[model samples]
Target: DAGITQSPRHKVTETGTPVTLRCHQTENHRYMYWYRQDPGHGLRLIHYSYGVKDTDKGEVSDGYSVSRSKTEDFLLTLESATSSQTSVYFCAISESSRSGNTGELFFGEGSRLTVL
Candidate 1:
């Protein structure tokens, strides 16, 4: 696919540290989101950015932040890593051609994180 790619597919971190994940897209999508996926909880949106330099907190924004200064890049940062944050993170892009709902998303392979 000619969509998006995430860096550092896997990571292991200690509690009380900092971590940042990168998401790069090729299609120059307008909507980008950073989400954490767990077994029981599915996907929890940490943050979402609509346009460049415009972002808002989502359902689970605590201890996490995001920035999108360019059209193709969005970064997610965990201020203080925690054991509870151990999960698979996914970056996704939403786009629509015919223009209805934008419909579905294309996701990166995902980044696995473990905190001990």
Candidate 2:
């Protein structure tokens, strides 16, 4: 096992509501990322952290934020959610390889957030 799991496998909320999704990992790795996936589009990065207490925003970072004060946990928060954000959210971790990233990431099943 890659030692990763996302919480609230399923979530339902109304538009404009505040939502928080949790990502937990036990890989003891240095990189963690949060992404959203929707139809007709590839995985879009929302936010990511390079190490404990070290984080940065990503391409589609609007309406979202993240926190990582511990090595095994990362959290994503939607200040005011929207229907556009009602997509499947995934947490992934990259293992350092002498061979480079290899674009390989171990992902948690996913957290499906539905905003009505």
Candidate 3:
């Protein structure tokens, strides 16, 4: 719960429209991540940012994009909404995990998006 906040926690949009989700944190953590959760797929990473303006694509980043201009904020956007992208999106923050240590990720509640 590391002071993470997500906006527009619930949204419904039509296909082909643009959608954006905002994640704001006060923890000043170095790593921020975006993930989507769906039935049978658990949670899949969409994108992640390691530092200010430094980001990378993840396994499920086909239609998603992300940006981090500051340490406490991260944004995820879907260029064009699709039914397949309708899912619960989560924002997580974590520090580097070390060997033999249990790595923990603090996640925001969630942002649910529906594409109709």
Candidate 4:
């Protein structure tokens, strides 16, 4: 949703390999976030950026890196893939309201990554 598009919707990789999932948005929202969804963990934040090149680490940021060079692109990179990192990753875009982070996010379908 929100004019977001995730690339490599499904991927299977070996442990220790490197992988990158891309999220592109057409809405030009002011904020973008990376979240992972697991069976028991639900949705957890991985990283988020409020503006281009301005990013902050999230709760589950370890072993992952994100880059936002433009308002329309957000890239999530896994330096070394691991089995524990297997999950559905989502990209969300939102605009800050007068009250700040309205907590209303529009998410992309999701990118499923599995590490063997």
Candidate 5:
């Protein structure tokens, strides 16, 4: 397992508030990803970074932002958290996962956030 840590493992907040989730890794992998899990929709990507300061929005990026200032840290922020954003957020690290090259996604324990 990779050395990954997520802060504030559990949180409760009201609607229209802001929230930030931090992901730290010691594996020094080049790629890091943020995803949210919900019932029906399963797991959806919020954002990902390939390198320091190089990030791209994912399919479900609305109201969400991400930053990667260092190789081992990735930050995900919710500008204005809503009730619908309540879900378990996961931070994943991978060496590579494109084309013929196969890579495994190592996920953190997860951060559960609830909005009222």
Candidate 6:
């Protein structure tokens, strides 16, 4: 398992507030990803970074932003959190294989957020 940690395992905040979630890894994997798990969405990608300062948006990235300043850290920020953003956010790390990305990911426990 990769050494992944997510801060503020649980949180509750009002709508329109800004929230940031931090993901830290000790494995130094080449790739990191943020995903939100909802009842019907399974795991939907919010953003991902392939290397330091290299990031791209994903399927559900409208209200989210991400930053990767170091190999071991990735940050996700919701500019103005909304009720629809209430979900379990997961951080996953993976290393690329010789041919390509292994597509295997080790996930953190998860951060649960609620917007009232």
Question: Model 4, 11-73: lDDT tens per residue?
Answer: 999999999999999998989999999998999999999999999999999999999999999
RMSD of each candidate relative to the true structure: 1.5, 1.4, 2.1, 1.0, 1.9, 0.8
Q: For candidate 2, which ten residues in a row score worst on lDDT?
A: 95-104
lDDT, residue 73, candidate 4: 96
What are the per-residue Cα lDDT tens digits for candidate 3 across 1-116? Answer: 47999988999999999999999999887889999999999999999988899999999999999989889999999999999999999999887555532447899999999999
Task: List ranges where model 3 is wrong by over 4 Å.
Answer: 96-103
Give the residue spans of candidate 5 off by over 4 A.
96-101
| Best-to-worst ranking by lDDT | 6, 4, 5, 2, 3, 1
Worst 10 residues of 4 by lDDT: 95-104
Error of 4 at 102 (Å): 1.1
Worst 10 residues of 3 by lDDT: 95-104
Q: What's the lDDT for residue 114 in model 3?
A: 98
Clashes, model 1: 0
Candidate 5, position 65, lDDT: 96
Count of clashing residue pairs in every prediction: 0, 0, 0, 0, 0, 0
lDDT of 1 at 40: 91
In model 1, state the lDDT of residue 27: 89
The TM-score obtained by model 3 is 0.92
TM for every model, in the order presented, reads 0.92, 0.93, 0.92, 0.96, 0.93, 0.97
Q: After superposition, how far is residue 38 of candidate 1 from its true place, in Å?
A: 0.4
Which 10 consecutive positions of candidate 5 have the poorest summed lDDT? 95-104
Q: List the residue pairs that clash in candidate 1.
A: none
Compared with the true structure, all predictions reach lDDT values of 0.90, 0.92, 0.92, 0.95, 0.93, 0.96
lDDT of 3 at 90: 97
Best-fitting candidate, measured by lDDT? 6
User: lDDT tens string, model 5, 1-116?
Assistant: 78999987999999999999999999989999999999999999999999999999999999999999999999999989999999999999998545732557899999999999
Cα RMSD of predicted structure 4: 1.0
Error of 6 at 85 (Å): 0.3
> Candidate 2 lDDT, tens digit per residue, 1-116?
79999998999999999999999998888889999999988799999998899999989999999999899999999999999999999999986678766667899999999999
